[model samples]
Target: MEFLDLQLVHALKTDGRAPLRRIASVLGVSDQMVARRYARLRETAGLRVVGRLNPRPVGQTVWALRLQCVPSAALGLARALARREDTRWVKLAAGGTEVVCHLAVRGERERDALLMGRIPASRAVTSVTAHRLLRLFKGGPTGWDGIASVLTPEQRDALAPAYPPPDARAQPVRLTDLDHLLLTALARDGRTTHAALAAEARCHESTVRRRIAHLRGAGALFFVLDIDERSLGGPSATALWLSVRPARLAAAGAELARHPEVAYAAATTGRTNLLATVLCRDDEQLYDYLAERIGALPGVDTVETAPIVRTLKRTGSVARDHDPADGAPRR
Candidate 1:
């Protein structure tokens, strides 16, 4: 990707909803050039742009799982785990001895059962360790330095705006303890039936339905979408850290939140004041995103990124345990 390409990515990273004309003006290029480059990046590289939701807001729990496996079996084990619908991101690290996976789930018990019961049964997996994300200090794609320099004062003023319009508000509803339990259950399995949730939550089936409706109305529950990156030909995912002036935090975060490639963006406390995550198609796209898109945002002084070498766990779920049905342990 060219220097200008990085600028476009940064602009998109800040605001996926940014108009092409705005991007062109910022880069001192025509809208057609920007559009052409973006198209090429998407079509040739299989890069995708999507909005990511915060798991916690929707009652989904995130966790990281670390797996120890035989060196040769690591790839096979990762492949099998990745195929499961519950699995999100998987990483191979520690010289192939460790496999980390991010998982999303509903409640602590079910998540525990999955880890202790299901994964240990697999012959490929030798051991597993899980950690819940207590608080998200940072997440997202790296910023672009090249574009930061390219952005002129007027361009920055034009690009950086106040908050985008708020999303539609869902009406709130009262929830009982059973309601919380049911919501937690469905958070783990979006497709779970009312009967299943009722059984787990220890409530009547009709109560489960009512509580679900109330939770949905309150915007406390949401459907989980399982995306197949391989099917889309996208490469692995990465998280980025950005340090920006405190005075500019809101503007920077608001802009970063709009990028389609960015799945999560938030202001945080630390050396890197801002965090964002991005999904790409390959190394080329990742490079382009970091160099062009992320580097260009206003008020960003520096960007640091670490590729998720492995997802130990995500959304509070385990990777390996014995299969409850078969009584076979997952390796």
Candidate 2:
């Protein structure tokens, strides 16, 4: 990817709904050029700008699950998990036998049933470790600041969403069967227009517009930007397991979230309360981050780092050897 590619991603990470013309104006490029670059990136990189729901604020729960399976079954199982709407993030880890993913459920009962019933019964799964996510330090569109240097503050402000205060988050929404249809469409493409959604949901266009706005304002939906890290010239991603003192967990988490290297970080229930994904240019830079940054943080008792070998699935896009000429991930 070029400098312009990174700028376009940064702008979209701020606002997935921002018009192409607006993005072009902010970047000092023609709308057609911006559109062409986006098309190329999506075509070559398996990029996805998706509308995702933030479950936490809506009385929902998220659990980080690591499934250890036979190496032969790992990719297929990961694909199955990725296809499920309830399973948000799924990745085949560096240790080829393990598949790491998040299960976002609406209620405690649903979360319990999934862990105790369906997963354990799977013949391919040898072991299951579920960690309840207690708090989110990052891991959403708003937290991806890795491209911060590419956009000016003024440009960024123009695309950012209005983040209401913690106390102001909307309550869990009551869903009609039809609401699920609207959400399914949004999940695939957040930028899917209202008229299209109405046609799909078999509802009036005004109803589509009202429902979408309500969901957005109700904290039931949010936008996330996903792009190929290989194309960005920085492909290495690491998952860090951190043990922190109970008293200082919040402080340590907040501090860790401030670092641009962190793509996803959260407090979970397990021996390691903190799990984070760190993005770096290479091994040397990763060493620096783990040492000078994470190691320097107060109350961090211990840390274990695992480099992600390849991402099998991101938010909504699965990794394939898209650039078939070389038979490799797009880069």
Candidate 3:
């Protein structure tokens, strides 16, 4: 990616809905230049800004599933899972023998139907492990650390989103039918014009605009950028599962989230309580990270590294009419 492309991404990460004019002002470039760069990035680099539902704020449960499938069934099963709206980050790991994804469900009944009834009954799945996400130290709405540091502090501050206070966040915001439709359209393209959203939602443009602002302010909605990491020049991507002392789990996870290599970090329930994905420039850098950085972390007992072979899905939920090349929901 060009230096300017990287900066634009960082700005979007800060606030995905920021106007191109505002982004250009922060980057000290012409608004047309920013627009051209964004369009080119989307066309060539597979860049997508998607509005995603924040499950936590809505009383939903999040679980990570690692399914060891028969080698022949791996790709098929990964694609099937990716097609589900409940699954995200679907990947083929452990040399294409494992399908891993994050599952979000509304309640125990919904969770049980998938985790207990459906998944366990699959004949092709050799083994399966489910980990409940207890806390997220990074990723999700926090964004990844890879392109996070590209923008200057002043630039970031200029684009950072204004979130509601804790008191407001504590109350779950009920979503309307229109809200769901609006979000569905935005999921396909976060920068979709307000008029387009209104047409999709079958409502007035002003109403669509107000509802979007309300959802964002209520913490029910947030934006995520899904991009081709290859453009960022990373040669290695590995998933790390760590067993850390309970007393130090939070601290360890927090510290790990700060590392530039970590794309996602969270605390989960299972034998390995912490999970993280790290991207390195090369194998040598990966070794240095494992040997020095991880080795220096406190209270981390054991580390399990699984090299990511391929990603079937990344940041967006797969809509019914999904585009094959990218994970975009059909408009």
Candidate 4:
């Protein structure tokens, strides 16, 4: 993907449902050109602009799972976890012998089936570390704001959602089967039109629009824009585990969110209360970020970094493990 495509991703991150013509106007390009680039990206980059439910207000939880196992079982386990609907991200780290996954915990029954029943029974798994996310200072669309500078202030404002504070309380919603159908369609393709969404959900277009607005208002749904990593400097990724005092976690998370280098960060359970992913050009730059920036933060007890050797899956999109610019999966 080119810089223009990256800017397009930034625009979409702000408003995934924005019309191509509107985005083109902001990017100062012909509407046709913008559409062509998006088509190419969808085909070549394997990008998915998907919808995700907000779990916090719904009595749900998010946890980061770290598994250290023999090298032989690493990829197999990572792929297996990625295939499950509960997992949001699965990464092969520690030079391919370790696996890190994000679990969106919905209820105790679901959690037990995953953490106790299914995981412990797997063979060759040496260890498991579960980090329950207590709070998320920045996630989803909020975490991608650093790239918004590509657009002018007016363009940015135009793309903002009419929905109130992104932090609005989310009451749990028991979606009907029809509601799931609509949301699933949006998750597969957020740009689907009202007509298409209505068809998918077997409902009227008016009903589709009304339900979508309700979901948004209840803070039950949000969309995520997954841009190609090659456009994001390089493929080098790291997961940081930080030990911060319980009282200072909120402040620490807020401070961490301001750093442009932070791709995602949240407060978690276990010895470390914070887990963050940083994207950099290379190891040297990553070291500089850790030493000069993270080291400078107050109340940071300890910081451990795990470079992501390969991402098995991210937000339901499969990333190429080698030669990402060519968009080929590693063999």
Candidate 5:
């Protein structure tokens, strides 16, 4: 990622729906260049740029779980957990000594069934620790900045022509009040039936179906995924930060993104400019991955890692209601 490319990513992160012309102007680049680079970034990075809804406003809860498992069984257990509709994120940590998974559920009963019942049944899991997210300080990786400087204008321009023109007619469908009500209901319980949602929203099932289809097409809704690491027999999960040459960032980041163990990867500001989060099933997995997978990438200068002790809050909701500075009531 060149420094200019990093700037482009930052512009998009600020607003995913920002127009190409606007992004180009902000980065002091031509619209065509911005269009091309963004398209390539999305394709090469496997990144989904879409509107993110506040989970709590829609009535959902997020939780984090830590599991201890035997090294050999780690992959299988992780794969099983990853298959669940309630699991969203899964990571292998500390050489397969731990596995971390994020889940969304409606009530205590469902949560218990997942944690105590299904997880315990996995032959690979030895133990499990679950934490309900109480609050969230921040989530999501930072946009590129350090890499923006390395990209040449022509190189950036080369990336622009790849993007297809935006289709104005294909914009996301508008939601009715009733649709909002139904979405709110389903957000709380992703497994809820259409009839149930319709009843709660005071609409017919057909209306619910059409509205849901519209929301799905617009990327407003998706299936929730859940996983149990204990069953998978993996070790711990860790977060990592890396610094790389601005010119080589795009190629490097794209390479890391392809690793199956990596959960999230993005370009960001700060000392360790390129932020990458990965999951390892065991110590060997982590070591091999770092020593081989990450180390082999071009332009990498330094790597720093920290194990996530716990998640106070996650994607589904805002934990704290007070203001950050004074702790005053949020109005």
Candidate 6:
């Protein structure tokens, strides 16, 4: 990616649905130039702006599942998991023997049926563990600093959307059939026009716009960038499980969230409460990140690193069920 391309990406990270003219103004470029770069990125970098639902506010419990599968079954198992609507971040790690993913379920019965029943009965999986996310310090709507810092403060302010603080007294919003249809279209392309969404949802364009605003205002929807990791730094990333003292866990997670390399960080119910995804250019950079940055964090006891072999899914449903050849974009 070129410098201008990165800036455009950063601008989109700030506001995925911002018009090309707005991004152009922020980047100090012509609208045509921004449009050209964006089209080129979509063609080459697998750039996708996804409007994802926030499961937390919708009575869903999110769990990080790690399945130690037979070496031959890792990719197949990962692809299968990625096809499921309830899964996200489906990845192969631990030298291609472990399949890791995030799963969301509405209740204990749904959670147990998969976690305790079907998954445990699979012969290809040697073992599995589930970590319920207790609190999310970062990830989801939070843009990673690595790709988010290219724009100047003024540029960012120009692109940033104004969101009101959450209301504790507000009632939880339920997902309607129209909401599902609109989200399905937006997940494929977050910048999908209101007319397109209205066509699919069988509603007026104004209704589509108002419903989208309502969902976002209720803290039920936000946008995320689904760009190729190789465009940022490298083809792979490492997942870290840090055992931090409970007294300083919040501080440590917040610190990790600020690191440019960290794409996601959260506190979980597990032996190692702090989990983060760090991106580095190479093995040496990964080593330095573990040794210098993570090692210096206060109250961090032990850190476990699992270099991802491949990530099959990030934010949306898998576009294809088959694995890609090496060096190809996984999107």
Candidate with the larger TM-score of 2 and 3: 3
Query: Which 10 consecutive residues of model 6 have the lowest summed lDDT?
Result: 320-329
Q: Runs in model 6 with CA error above 4 Å?
A: 164-171, 319-331
lDDT of 2 by residue, 218-280 (tens): 767778877767666765888888999999999988988899888888999998899999889
lDDT of each: 0.59, 0.78, 0.82, 0.79, 0.57, 0.83
Candidate 6: the clashing residue pairs are: none
Candidate whose TM-score is highest: 6
**Model 4 misplacement above 4 A:** 145-148, 165-169, 318-331
The model with the greater lDDT, 1 or 6, is: 6
Clashing pairs for model 3 are none
> Can you write out model 3's per-residue Cα lDDT over 1-331, one digit (the tens) per residue?
7889999988887878899999999999999999999999887767778888877777787899999999988877888888888887887788879888999899899999998888889888998899999887888666564743589899988988787422213558788899888877888888899988888777899998889888887778888887767667755678899999999998899899888888889899999999999898888999999999999888999999888877767885442334565564421
Best by lDDT: 6
Give the poorly placed runs of model 2, Cα more than 4 Å off: 162-170, 320-331
| Model 2, global lDDT | 0.78
lDDT, candidate 4, residue 14? Answer: 82
TM-scores, each model vs. reference? 0.49, 0.89, 0.91, 0.92, 0.48, 0.93
What residue pairs are clashing in model 4?
A: none
**Residue-level error in angstroms, candidate 1, position 110:** 4.3
Better of 5 and 6 by TM-score: 6
* RMSD to true structure for each model, in Å: 12.7, 2.9, 3.6, 2.6, 16.4, 2.4
Candidate 2 residue 200 C-alpha distance from true site, Å: 2.3
Least accurate stretch of 10 residues (summed lDDT) in model 2?
163-172
lDDT of 6 by residue, 165-279 (tens): 2332335779988898998899889999999888887789999989889988898888887887677755358988889999999899889888888888989998989989988
lDDT of 1 by residue, 242-312 (tens): 88888887777877766656765656555667766677767798898888877777788998665654443
Candidate 3: lDDT of 222? 84
Model 3, runs deviating above 4 Å: 145-148, 164-169, 317-331
